[model samples]
Target: MTDIVVSTDWLADHLDEVRVVDVRDGWEFDGIGHIPGAVNVPFDTIRAAEHAVERGADPAEGMLPGVETWEEVLGGAGIEPDDTLVAYDDTHGVFAARFLVTALAYGHADVHLLNGDFSAWSRDHEVERGTPEVEPTEYVARESETSPFVDFETVEAALTADDVAVIDTREPDEWAAGHLPGAIQLDWRELVDDDSRGLKPDAELESILADHGVTPGARVLLYCNTARRISHTYVALRHLGYEDLMFYEGSLAEWEARGAPLESA
Candidate 1:
């Protein structure tokens, strides 16, 4: 697996070589300065609104959009399937990781997340005030043959499967309120280093996961309130060389909305 995290210094050296994507809100991209030559692809644009309703889930739940939508949104942002993408956001890589995960799911092979937050970049490097010039491309996205995202049925089955480990990447309060039965709590924040605001060392991360019974050997299924928080943990696990990993896209929102049984702390 390719190294999914790139340092700001590495990004600075190769800014022109890669497609720099600022995954912040539109207002933030324009109002706050951004890395020069970077294109703004707001996090919300990549996620589907009212997607849960289609899955018999809450109407407010956000899920990954369809292939056509991804093709349009990414292509409009001047991103081709073969583009070397580096996505960053103010939220310590979570929003950026979400974009990377979505791109990977759509078979974009050379995607990466910028290590640390955008604030650190803006503070140290020169930034542009407005949108950069972009010429849109006709991008075609193909769904990956082996996708990391798993549906509700797969998650439901995993609950009873001894080999599968269902991990809840939510806060203590959220897990306390309710979570899927047999789901182990591993808050996504633990995967990130507080000082650097990037992922912890690989061994440390692996140790943390192992402590929670989330070993790489086991088939890991991760989820949060939505798919957002878990995206960070997903990237972290991938970075640590975990192969048999899956994400519950609908997550707790879908689980609860569908009247599935839940176990509270």
Candidate 2:
């Protein structure tokens, strides 16, 4: 399955075929208008926990809600099991990528992240401004227990094992301050270079990994400040045909709270 990026023009052309999911929080969309026909899927709704990750915490936290909750949410959106899901958010696609990853984990065949997120779309003037009013639909409860995620315990165990490669997908500064023990640093920006947002290209991500001795079939456990940005790397790795890849959904905050062994490089 391919994760395709649709331009504003492209989205305009195939509005019916594609489902544009606006992942902005309530305040953002309510204050500012959103793309016409885009359904609001508030970022807060997909919480890792009742409370979220704290700033500057370790990178191994987040949780997937029960399948019943997901089914209600997806079904309420009128999402057909087979429709193409396109998710976007204002930031560097952290929210969008997480949602896309979540949906794909739920067995939705066609889920994509809007490149550069809503900010890029707005910069291109590719977005339509409107207060979308979607009628609440009757959601049928469909139970399925297949949420793709990794908890702090699993990450802690992997850190002690030589077989699993623990990757820190946070920035260089974050990596230097503190990171899980035995984890290798590979910034998420290495995968998606967003210079406009103070992100410089580590143009040779795969090469850098190769230098770090990350092999083709290495079992990777990817984590970041939050699971959001790292999910993009998770998707990209899978896209690159890596078979044994997994993302730590809770990320750094949770890991630090549990007092897991960490190293400052």
Candidate 3:
């Protein structure tokens, strides 16, 4: 899997070459200005929101669906496998970064997350209003995700494993609310810094992961209430050369649904 990110300046220079996607809520896209030529692909559209609605799943859960659904959602946004995609969010890069991860899971290789997001980009970049039209394409998913993502079963098995590191990338309150029995706390926001509030310097990032016992050699599973917050940490660790990184997309909420015990620590 490719572990690279693009800066706002670079995106501005090649807006014509790259497919710029805004992954904010639909209302936010209408109310807030966006990058010129950018198309809306709200984060939920790429996730399992539809599936959740059909099955009566939790409203806040954000996870992936089947490949067919992914292909349709992406194609509807004019996304093709060969196109270079750069996604950004109005607030945090969670939605934007998740966009990149979701694309990879659907076999789209040329994807990127805009470093500073819309807030960082809008400070000096060109902004536009109104929506843009996009013609759907016949895109097909060739694989799931290139990065490691575990099912609830796999995560449960790892819970007792000595070598595996399970990290809870939620806020302290979320942690205190209730979490997986053996998860260690590591807030996602603290691991990143900069005007964009993205990943910090490589050295600092390394230190954060190291402190959490999530070194390159460790088999790590990261998660939050939903998958969005954890994805921010996943991106940072992936860039730090943590190949054994795994995303527990189901997270603790899914775990509880499975009758798994929780620890209110």
Candidate 4:
């Protein structure tokens, strides 16, 4: 399916055919560990600083690293270009979604976000964990120039516009710690079902938006700590037929770099 959410059973059945990624930050994965055969890529390092110049990232923001950069990483992890990618993280679906969106934008098809994320995966008692075996291969990531990245200029304009809604998809603690001014909080965890396993029920998602006063035609800007999890919210909103959604690609990292206004509430 174009909508990729795989069950634990499915993952187990096809473990070797899928390139599983534990996209959690260093601290999170360090303590709790990850799936067997899954490789670790701390979320922010998605853009290789040295290769950014050729990978479609803004030069001023630091370009995204080229295909060789991803090639080295994925190749080192024994990943094959033909294999499906399955990503997961502890931060609900935000990081996983962000990774999937960026991967798709970079032309990596056959990608899936593990349904219900790490929580659901951990619920099963027989699952195995291991330090992934590493091997080498010549890999390449095809780049796309039109991935709809939102920069500071766009964010500034949206902030002043009455028609736009800037969403902060961080956890409640992080949101309370601080956020961009005029942004609304919507923890990504709440957007998925705890039982059925993938995205939240459609009616429930619509009700959540209604509670937040987000309407169909609203121009929405979605962001999280690093723009990782925010992309999932972007996809979720789009699924609900929100027509004018954009992802703040660099997210709070870029906002803080630009000295944008922020507040704690």
Best by lDDT: 1
lDDT of each: 0.81, 0.66, 0.75, 0.69
Output the better candidate (2/3) by lDDT: 3
Q: Which consecutive 10 residues in model 2 have the weakest lDDT in total?
A: 195-204
lDDT of 1 by residue, 1-265 (tens): 1688888888999988899999899889988878888899998889876545456643222377767888988888988777899999988899999898888778887888888878868767888887777889999987586468777777788888889888888888888899889888888888888777788878898899889988777888887765678888888877777788877766555567778899998
Give the alpha carbon lDDT tens digit for every residue of 142-196 in model 3. Answer: 8655755666777788888898888998888988889887788998787667565
The sequence of per-residue lDDT tens digits that candidate 2 reaches over residues 1-265 is 2534444556666767777888898667766766667887787676545444454323333544445666677776666676688887877766777887777556665777666666666665545555665665554433224334665667667777787887788877898988878778876666664743212233455676677667677898887765676776776566545667767756454566667667898
Which prediction has more favorable lDDT, 1 or 2?
A: 1
Q: CA lDDT of 226 in candidate 1?
A: 58
Per-model clash counts, in order, read: 0, 9, 1, 6
lDDT value for model 4? 0.69
lDDT of 4 by residue, 181-259 (tens): 8889997667877675568878988889878878778888777654556777876876666767766655455566668
- Which prediction has more favorable lDDT, 1 or 3? 1
Check candidate 4 and list the clashing pairs.
51-65, 52-63, 52-64, 52-65, 94-229, 95-229
Q: How accurate is candidate 2 locally (lDDT)?
A: 0.66
Better of 2 and 3 by TM-score: 3
